[model samples]
Target: MAHRFQYTVISILSAVLQKCGLRCTRKFGKMLGLLLMLQTKRRMITYDNISKAYPGHSDEWKGALVRGAYVNLGITFAEMLYSKALSADDLINQVTFSGLDVVAERARNGLPSILLSGHFGNWEYLAMAAGVCLHKPLTIVVHPQHNAYLDAELNTIRTRFGNIVVPMHKAARTLVRTIQEGGIVAFLADQHASADHDPQIEFFGRPTPTYSAPAALALKFNVPMFLGTAVRHDTGKYSVNVQPVPSADLSDNPESVIELTHRHVAMLESEIRANPHLWSWQHRRWRM
Candidate 1:
């Protein structure tokens, strides 16, 4: 009964989003974000996080950033909903890709690579577009959504353009199989992991719990890792940037895991730093 209700809601939302199209939906999302910041107290979390990261900035500077972040969050939410209704025509015009041949080259040379990225820009679109952009099937490791029905729907959209999704629990086995078979694997590596056991890495001038799976996998497989990001442009479009993480000197070892992990985190931080407004800052990433 609950699943039926969820499906009904999703169908109605998808229809409305499809009608509104990407551009207008994004405008709606921006407005939604503004309303959220103005009406809700969650803006406090945004302000606090910004202060910690950019302590030297004045309150006005920080507030402007926070507004941008909230607007980004709203735009992202709308985009994700519209993803379900996205057509190839809509995707092609809305997002553009660069540096894909670099990673795709690995497969041509019998090398399987790990793609690392963060929650910057339209991350969901980044993965979704990479499916078609790379000209090859991408194996994405994602955390499962609590709602089984919703999770199924997400995978449907994710795989619509020739990509695969594997849940976190099954990621180890699936990634190994894919890598051994000379396939590409992607990971969203920017989120804060459980601090209880996860190693803390320096990010944005502070030690933060970071996921090391991608680093470990890259080292163990002795394959190259590519750091990618889908950045938003003033034209209301997205541009994907993919480049290799400089780690040719590192061998498969515990030390390499830490070093590679830091390198990827730093890469993500650089992107977030370059475009501070494109990132979601209200999630309270800095526990300190």
Candidate 2:
């Protein structure tokens, strides 16, 4: 009964938000962000993250960035809920791509790739747009939501546009077979990993835990890899930049995984630095 109630409430909210259209929804979402900024504990965590990631900045600058981060997140949430109404061609038209030739070439030659990105910007669109652009289904590794009803509802939005969603624990075999069959797979490399999970990497000059599956998988399969992000512009349209993952060497050497992972981390860090507001800072991403 509770699950049904939750699903009903979320469905109603999504419908109401989409009726306002993208621009109005984002405006209202930004107002919602202001409310989030008032939460003391989360505000402090966000402040500390910004302070450490960027030192020597005044409190005012950090405050604006933190506030903007929340607003960005609100907009992201609104856009994601509104995405259910978008058609495949509508999704494709919303994004302008850079380095699409890489995806195009890989798709044409029947070569699989690991498409990686952080939590910055509209990361969901990155996966969806890639499927449309490459004309192949993409398997995205996703952490399961604890609530089964919400999980099913959210996963429907994710897979609605010709993409496959794999729960993280069950992703290994599915990812391998999908790539072997000449398909693309995507992963979020910026999420936190426990020290034991083999996610040692440097982010924003701080030693932090990060998911290394992207590098490990790419190296293991000898597949091509690309890092991409969908950045929202002032007009609310997104421009996606997909580039080859720059790395030293991708041999099976143990150090190669660390190096490749750092390369992906560095790329994401650069993007976040360029637009700190577009990235989420509310989480406890860094340890004091």
Candidate 3:
């Protein structure tokens, strides 16, 4: 009965979102974000996170950044809902690749790779763009939504353009096998991991718990790893920038797990610093 209600709400939302189209829906999302920014709970979380990350910034700066963060997420949400209307080419054309040659060369040699990114930009679109470029489906590690109806709907959209979604809880062995079979695996490594399993890593000069699975897998399977970002442009298009993870970082020595993980976190931090507004700052990133 609860699932039915959830499905009904999503059905109505889908109908309304489709009618709004991409551009208009994004505009509406931006406006909605502005309204959401006024809500105390999320507003405070965003402000606190920004203050911690940018210590010297004024309240005005923090507020503007918080609003921008909300707007970015709103745009992303709108684009995602409207994406079902887009064909593969439409999705592929939305992003320009800066380091395709590197990825292509690696792919040509049948080398499996682990691609890492954060919560910046439209991460789902990033996966879609890579799927188009790689000429094969890429398996992505994702946290399953608690709402069964919503999860199924989201999974359909995510996989519509030839990508596989692997639930995070049971992905360790599957990810290893996927890479071993010369397949691509992607991870959003910025999210906070469980306290018990997470490795401490530095982000913006503060210690935070981060998922170490990607680093551990890269070392264990000796697979190449790359860190990349999908940067949104003023034209509403996006460009993907990918950089290879240095081999030295993923040293076979067990001690290197934390080191490799730090490098990934650092890469994301650098990107976030460059475009502070592009990230989701409302999420509690640090316990400190």
Candidate 4:
């Protein structure tokens, strides 16, 4: 009953938001950020985490990043609201892609590859752009919100360009089947996970729980794994860089999966270091 009510409220809110213009979306995000900053414990945790990660930075510098993170989050939400209205040409003009050959090589071999990325820089746009560039629909694993109406609406927008959005609950089976059937699967690996689901891995010099599903699937199917990141440039444009993960023959044991996962996370860490402001710092990524 509570879930149903939540869904109804979200549906109405989404409808209202959709009708509102871009200005309204931006305002909504700002209002949300203000509320989160004022009431959420997560805000302080995020600020402290950023400070700890960059010890040498001044307090003012760290505060700027925190504010930027919230602003980016607002932009992300606004983008999500109108992502379907965006066209391939618009995305192409806004986003630059590097390492096409890496994706092309995998596609040429008739073996599907697992593309792993994090929640950075309007991730929805990145998936849509991938579908456009690859000329094939990319299957994304997503954890839908509890609100059913909002979830459905959001999924509709996400799959507007024909990319499939699979629910996380059935992701493993769906991913394996997609790979076996020669379909590309993309994973967003930076989300916080339960300790049991994802063991602690070093991220930003701290032990953060990270998902290993991408590594496990890549190794199990002997498919290539690629590291991709979408970074927001100063002019409100995005650049996506895809790199091939180090080849690992994973015939040995399950522990090999953990090592491969760490390598991918390490690569992501390097990218984050290069531009800490673009990364999602609002997440309570580390427990302590």
**lDDT of candidate model 3 versus the reference:** 0.84
Kindly list the per-residue Cα lDDT of model 3 for residues 102-149, writing each as its tens digit. Answer: 777777888888899889988889998888888877899999988888
Candidate 2 residue lDDT tens string, 1-288: 888898898788789887877778778777878887888999899899999988999999998998889988888877887887788888887777898778788889988888888788888877888888888888999989877998998889888878999998898899989889988889987777777766668887788987777787888888777887788888887888887886535696668878888888888888888888988888777652
lDDT of each: 0.84, 0.83, 0.84, 0.80
Which pairs clash inside model 2? none
Candidate 1 lDDT tens digits, 151-204: 888788788888899987788999999999999999988766878767799988
Models 1 onward score TM values of 0.92, 0.95, 0.95, 0.87
Error of 2 at 261 (Å): 0.5
> How far in Å is the alpha carbon of 124 misplaced in model 4?
1.1
| Pairs in steric clash, model 4 | none
Lowest lDDT 10-residue stretch of candidate 3: 246-255
Model 2, position 63, has a per-residue lDDT of 89
Model 1 ranges off by over 4 Å: 1-7, 38-41
Cα error of candidate 2 at position 128, Å: 1.3
Q: Is candidate 2 or candidate 3 better by lDDT?
A: 3
Model 4, 90-152: lDDT tens digits are 766767789856776667676698888887877888888888777788999998887776788
Which portions of model 2 miss their true places by more than 4 Å? 1-4
For candidate 2, give the lDDT of residue 58. Answer: 98
